[model samples]
Target: MLSILDRYILKKYLGTFSLLLLLFIPIGITVHLAEKIDKILENEVPMTEVLIYLYNFTIYFANLLFPLFLFLSVIWFTSKLANNTEVVAFLSSGVSYYRFLRPYIIGATIVCAAALVFSMYLAPKASKGFNEFAFKYFNKGRSDRDQSNVYTQINDNDYIYVSYFNVTEKIGSNFTLEHFEGNKMTYKIAAGQIKFNDKDSTYTLFNYSKRKIGETNDILKTQHKLDTVFAFSMEDLTPVTYIAETLNFTELNDFIKKEKARGSSYINRYEVVRYKRWSLPVSAYILTVIAVAVSSVKRRGGMGVNLAIGISIGMVFIFFDKIFGTMAEQSSFSPFIATWFPNFVFGILAIYLLRNAKR
Candidate 1:
């Protein structure tokens, strides 16, 4: 039961967006492949893995730049409509400006839903593969985890520290574990070096010593080498920096809960990722409105002028998003505020522009 005008405009909106993605994704892949081909050749990476990496990279790249694609696509087609005086004809035919905007809103909703799905599920899977391949082949010898001066609370009464950890080797120097009971030290374990045995799921401590506190005296035990099991996993020592990006919505929530319980210092970073998953999809509507308003008025300079304006606005939006996101991740800034501030600012802009366009 859709009107002809609604069908026409909706078709144009979705068709233009789809065409933009089809055109740009291949260019992105070509550019990426060109930049990384040398490394791929040197590493002798298999063709099968390379193809899989490209597939993941496409999703990662698309998700990262979806808003820009959407904005530009809207501007492109809307400008074309304005240049052809289609908008003027529609408005003259007793269609109010708001009525004229119906199809665009419908298109935005569709895109927003798809974006939500991508962020919640598809993007995380792609991110895991994308980051894993980059770290494994392109960034060998570099770690995605903090390998120096590691400290963490594994559970309520247990804390561990290491001066330096080798993520690849699963080894550490200057390892110490402390147990406390009601603000009193219960026992402490220290070792000059520690190595995890993956096969046995145990730790081997060199120059190991343990001190047990008593009401009157402290009992000390020392050994040249000791093998034992602890209440923590090796992953608890140093989770990869991108660990938050690899988990889907539910998994991410569960992970953040566990990390919060463990007193993780990277909670802000994780929360930033969590908030962005929702924020990015919402921005689609704001950006769509802005794009239509900016491009719906025919200009003397034609479509190029609208495109210039769109690109500048897009760049500023991305800049604000990255700057605030980084601040939230690195500082005590609220992740919710950081993630949504750009959208809030741009939404106000969208309102102002829409009002002007109506005039």
Candidate 2:
């Protein structure tokens, strides 16, 4: 039992969003292709591989810039309604402003659900495929090791450190592992170089030395070659930039838990990604409210003026998101705060504008 007005607004909202996505995605693909064409030709990549890359890129780009497109679409269609005086007619017909906003909320909910699904499942797969394709074909000689000066907690009693690690070869230099009991160091192992044997699932330590601490004295052992097993694996030593983007919501949470346990320095960046997945969907509701409030009032300059305003606001929002995201990744800023601060600030603005629009 839906009202005619509700159906009309809902249709316009969803239809406009679809149209905008279709219109802009090709332009995005074209620009991306133009930039990457030289790399494709230089690498002598096949057309079939290029097509698959573009397919994955489509999903990646759409999910990446979802909010901007949604904001512009809302502004475009709502401004059209305002220019036609449809909003005024509806208001004059005894529909309160809050009631008039219902269809917008409904429409946003639908889009938000879709966004959540995309981010949780589809986007991760697309991101993995896209990054893998780019790295395999375009980024020749690029190393996979994401960081230097790596430190990790192997377990409750063991810790490890590596001055540098090579992900391509599964090797590390200047490696140290320490085992502690309460406040006392029980034993320590050091190696000049360590290589992981994937077939054997063990480490080969060159120039290895071990120290066993005792109450009265310490015993030391030295060897030129040593093979041993640890609680961790090569994946633990080499973290990739795209690792967070490849995991779904459930996998992401588990990853965060494991990384936290391991005292990973990259945990901040991973947490930011986790928070943003949910925040992206929630922002759909916030942006829809702000969009309607901004574009519902008819202006002398027409749709172009409204679009200008919408684009300006969209740019500001994106700027804030990037700044805060960088802070979370580089500094000690909490990822939750960084992710939600933009929403809180913009939500207040939405409320202010909605009150003004009501009057």
Best-fitting candidate, scored by lDDT: 1
Candidate 1 C-alpha error for residue 148, in Å: 1.5
Clash counts per candidate, in order, are 0, 0
Model 1 weakest lDDT span, ten residues long: 231-240
| Candidate 1 residue-wise lDDT, 88-200, digit = tens | 99999999999989999999999999999999999999999999999999998899788888888899899899999998899999999999997988999999999999998
Best by TM-score: 1
Show the colliding residue pairs in model 1: none
Give the poorly placed runs of model 2, Cα more than 4 Å off. Answer: none
Off by over 4 Å in 1: none
lDDT of 1 at 33: 99
lDDT of 1: 0.95
Please provide, for model 2 over 1-359, each residue's C-alpha lDDT reduced to its tens digit, 9 standing for 90 to 100: 66999999999999999999999999999999999999999999989989989999999989978988999999999999999999999999999999999999999999999999999999999899899988887787885456478788878788888899987788899999999998799999999999999998999999999999999999999999999998888877777778999999999999999888878888899999999999988999889999999999999999999999999999999999999999999999999999999999999999999999899
- Model 2 clash count equals 0
